[model samples]
Target: MTIADKGPRTRPFEANWLARIGWLLLALYVVYAGAQLGFSWQRFSDGLGQGGKFIARMFPPNFTRWELLMSGIVESLQIAVLSTVVGIVISLPVGLLAARNLMPAWVTWPARGFIALCRSFHPIIVAILFVKAVGFGALAGILALIIASIGFISKLFAEAIEEISLKQVEAVRATGAGFTHILIMGVQPQVLPRFIGFAAYQLDSNLRNSTMVGIVGGGGIGATLFTAYQRFDYDFVLAMLIVIVAMIMVAEIVTGWARKVFQ
Candidate 1:
């Protein structure tokens, strides 16, 4: 064909004017917002210097109150474990009920609404409320984590169930199987692996939250850390932070192993 007869060559890349304009607007808004909020590089630099000095005071951590530290850590662990276990058990049925493909609208809507309510607030806010209701201690922390776990695990579980192969479910039904039998033979196989992974993740999250819940009087190391901070015991605060980090790292390892074994 003649060169002139060929169609126009298209560029490999095209500039999207709409996206470019959107990004430009976003940058402009950020600058305006920063100005309004008094955000300046000079202020940030000064804050960093102060933060460094505060961090310096945390060294040479005090371990003289080892008994108190140990008790708090143990309580946090108990809260995490109990909440994770209870949440997983409760999540199974709630998740099944919330699955749109499995349950009717009447059932699914209520279950979904309950899940949404559980997720509507932060765990710390929930912990505070539970502390008031239950009158504090580890019980409040456990209840708070349980609510958080239910919200997260149930939603994911429902989504997983919804994504399962309907063909397997139909096949099981064709065999004159009941709902329980079909769930066991068809649905469980597809979603169990994912559910286990979600449960492990919730456990890890609960472990971290258990520490924070104590700050609100839910009972954990967070209460101890808060007390240390109030008393200007930076050294003790550093010790608690170190212990919390170590506990989280160990929990992560255990959860990873559990996921691998389950999968």
Candidate 2:
């Protein structure tokens, strides 16, 4: 067992010439991008001064439109909740069918395709399409978020199901259980917690998206905020932003509590 007989000890990783060249190229690109974008310390300093004046004008936010704000908030909540419920209900079956171990290829392929289609676009893009098809309002927002939620949760849920312990599933099948019975007894128990987690996450996401969809005339606080911006009502815009932040914080807290309790 001499040093030379240790079978050529592996050398520690060191930066190679190629790695050094890559770093140099990255630095050069950053400098070029900064120049192309007109980035300058003097311009940044001037912009800070302009920002200070803008902030001064936005002080003492106007709550005179509290009624309008409340209405918008309620509509957003409804859209988020409705979308979550519908998405969760639909995703359950789709996810189950997409799990390759549980379903035949014919069933899984179509289910996967549907999930892919649902998730192909951003929620805002989907909302725009729905707004065009269904006319503008909460309905369009709800449909758009529902599609987004289904695409997200269903894909993750199917993967979770696929990764579950097949031994338990096989045991259930060995007891002369039907396919549905095996799913209920074995598969559902293993994946239920993960499913709940995905649902909670989707709810949180939908709440955030509900506010955004309104910018495209899908009824919510975003529409009001956009209008305020157009009218140069920076004070009202700031107020709306504060309310949105508070709402999102509350939602996060509630969802955390639900996850803990359920777990």
The numbered model that scores best in TM-score is 1
Residue 200 CA displacement from its true place in model 2, Å: 0.7
lDDT of 2 by residue, 198-228 (tens): 9889989999999989999887888999999
Worst 10 residues of 1 by lDDT: 3-12
User: All candidates' TM-scores?
Assistant: 0.93, 0.90
In model 2, which runs have C-alpha deviations exceeding 4 angstroms? 1-13, 36-43
In candidate 2, the residue pairs with backbone N, CA or C atoms under 3 Å apart (3 or more residues apart, or in different chains) clash, namely: none
Q: All models: lDDT?
A: 0.94, 0.93
User: Best-fitting candidate, measured by lDDT?
Assistant: 1
